[model samples]
Target chain A: MVEIATIVLILVGTFLMFVAGLGITRMPDLFLRMSATTKVSTLGMGAVMLAVVIYFDDLVATFHAIAIILFVFISAPVAAHVIGRAAYFTGVPLWEGTIVDELRGHYDLRTHQLESVPLPELEEHLPDVQVLKVLLPATSPLAGQTLAQINMRRRYDVTVLAIRRGDRMITNPGGDAQIQPADELILIGKSAKLDEVVSILRGLAR
Target chain B: MTPVQGLVVFVAFPLLTIAVILAFVRLVRGPSLPDRVVALDLISTLMIGIIAVYAIATDEPVLLDLAIVLALISFLGTVAFAHYLERRV
Candidate 1:
């Protein structure tokens, strides 16, 4: 019975490893490949190690296998995240099928760090109207849709003065301009209208 | 070893070996650098699995020591590669 169980474990582990190989070879882009290799292969190795523990039935071998499983579980996801971040910051093009880019302009290429959106300087003496920088997340419905189509002016009463994307700024974007995921829309309006725009972008209705 | 254990090892070793070779194919393609790194990481993990299978087939507990060291070293190598990918090293 133990032998059968071991064999089953080993077979399933090998199949998972094979699937990970297939995923790496067949996935369209680097990020997707990372997604495949990190989780699938780590789990495969864990299963194979479990089989070893069951087969040998020795304390030392089991300890070693457990240690390896712990290390793999801890490191694999972190490695994938770092690799994905590097690919993004280095401007590796996304696959054409990708509909959203969550980190497009949010990272610094040289430092390999995230760029914080600068909060507008709030001064009571200056003016009542405020300039708000609105960041669009990848899940935002506005993504892949043009500003003209959304008609933010009619919906939220806020004007999109400029759009900041990956170190380039588009001032006074025309009607044809498209709003991409992670785009920072520089809006100028009353604070109440800006609040409404924020809610809308967050996928919430007023 | 029993007949069932022997047969299991015989079947599993070849399958794992094929998986390793497939991962190697991905390593060589390298449409991008991170892809290559990921493939390398997969290869190392696969090697750990292979070593574990060997220990099981041979019934040698000592071999598990080598597997442990290999696993730890591969993790360190992966972390270093991640650092390199981030341009930190």
Candidate 2:
């Protein structure tokens, strides 16, 4: 009777492990693969360890097997979360159908750290709007052209108050003042608009 | 040999071997780094199962110690790799 039971447990455990392996191969995305793998493998190993306890039928062996089961049960989901968070932060693209990305726009590009608070939009009740200083990279389309050519006010709804170029500050520069490769523009606008301007200045599409 | 022992020696080991191979294929072909890491995590989990079964099949109960070591260390490995990924990238 114990022999039959042990055989069944071993089969079940190995079968589930096989299924998990199949899942990791067949799943479309990284998150999906992880979702399939982490939990299933835990159960599979748990069953296998239980079989070990039963088959050995010794106090020491049972204790060790149960310890393994407990350890695996605790660690699998946590490791999955760690890998997923790391992947998301390191520019891993999600599947197209993914919805409700709560972490978007919460990462600080400067520090590469997740912000506790989401990027704040200026309050409508306040009379003052947010101001940000943006640096345009050399590859930026707006780098070689004047502010007039880019239609800064019309397209972006942002004003460039001052241009700081290599210790030379041009205060409220004229429309025809061409931008150079390494100019820092002091911008005044809504936070979202400023973000848009900053992204574009940094040569990002969106 | 008893039927259960024969079944484990013959059937369980082969199925687990095939499982390991499948995970290995994913590890090799995983498109992104994290995908490979996920695969690595799965492979290690399967290894735990294999080691447990092997311990009993050989009747060497002390080998369960290796499974214990694997479980703790594999978790640490995954966390450390994740920490490396975000900071370095």
Candidate 3:
């Protein structure tokens, strides 16, 4: 009787998992795809894990299954959020069916504010040529260097527009400001030159 | 194997495998990084279900451990990939 019940549970779980895959392929947008995957796939996995617990009728397996299910429930949404936010920031266009894009509007407003600022003043306020924001790996050479010592503006023709240290921003940082691991640097410069600067920064400390 | 167990191993697992394969194809052909990441995540979740079915049909508790480990590794991998994509590093 337990065997038969196990078979029934497995079948149902398999069917739901298959449906999740289909939804991922057919969904019109990244958000929709993530929605389908997180909801349906997590449930499918939970069902299958539950089936295993039933098959064994053991407390250990049951506890393991429960742990996995709880982990999935907590992590799936966070992972989806990360993916969706990355796609949005990288300028991946949404499907036409999207009725509203709050992120786009918010970004546009911020860009407009930046554009309104006078260029001369912006340049005067910042020391380094702005390139792109990049994280400093532990191995990067710039990991421990002060802004003045790195001389990024003279070396790579890239300026540091701002420094994002965790949740706080250090705007118009001093020349003596030291770079640290996990610090995100907002740089600005010509595109090709910025790429080189980025490579150099990443290659540092690593 | 009993007829009922056969029904699950042959019928249900195969159907789920087909679906997972389709999603894998999408992961390979995805135009963007996020799309591929999402597809890979879905595939990993589906794989957990497939493994569970195998454990049940065979009545092996060991396979349950494998399923739990796969889930944790897949979740961590997805988060790391997403972070890489977001920072473009």
Best by lDDT: 2
Rank all candidate structures by their lDDT, best first, as comma-separated numbers: 2, 1, 3
True contacts kept of each: 0.64, 0.94, 0.81
Error of 3 at A94 (Å): 0.6
DockQ of each: 0.48, 0.78, 0.53
Task: Compare candidates 2 and 3 on lDDT and give the better one.
Answer: 2
Clashes of each: 0, 0, 16
Model 3 misplaced stretches (Cα beyond 4 Å): A1-4, A107-206
Candidate 2 per-residue C-alpha lDDT over A1-206 given as tens digits, one digit per residue, 9 for 90 to 100: 77777888999998999889988888888888888888788898998988887888799999999888888888888888888988987778777687645565455444556654322564454344665655566888778889899878899898888888887999998889888876878777776787788778878874
Scored against the true structure, residue A96 in model 1 reaches a CA lDDT of 80
Residue B45 shift from truth in candidate 3, angstroms: 1.0
Model 1, A122-147: lDDT tens digits are 44543556666667878886788888
Candidate 1 docking class? acceptable
Lowest lDDT 10-residue stretch of candidate 2 chain A: A117-126
Q: Would candidate 3 be rated incorrect, acceptable, medium or high by CAPRI criteria? A: medium
How well does each candidate superpose onto the true structure, as a TM-score? 0.69, 0.71, 0.64
What digit string (tens of lDDT, one per residue) describes model 2 on residues B1-77? 77766877898888888888988999999799998888888888888888888777788999999999988988999
Candidate 1 chain B, run of 10 with poorest lDDT: B3-12
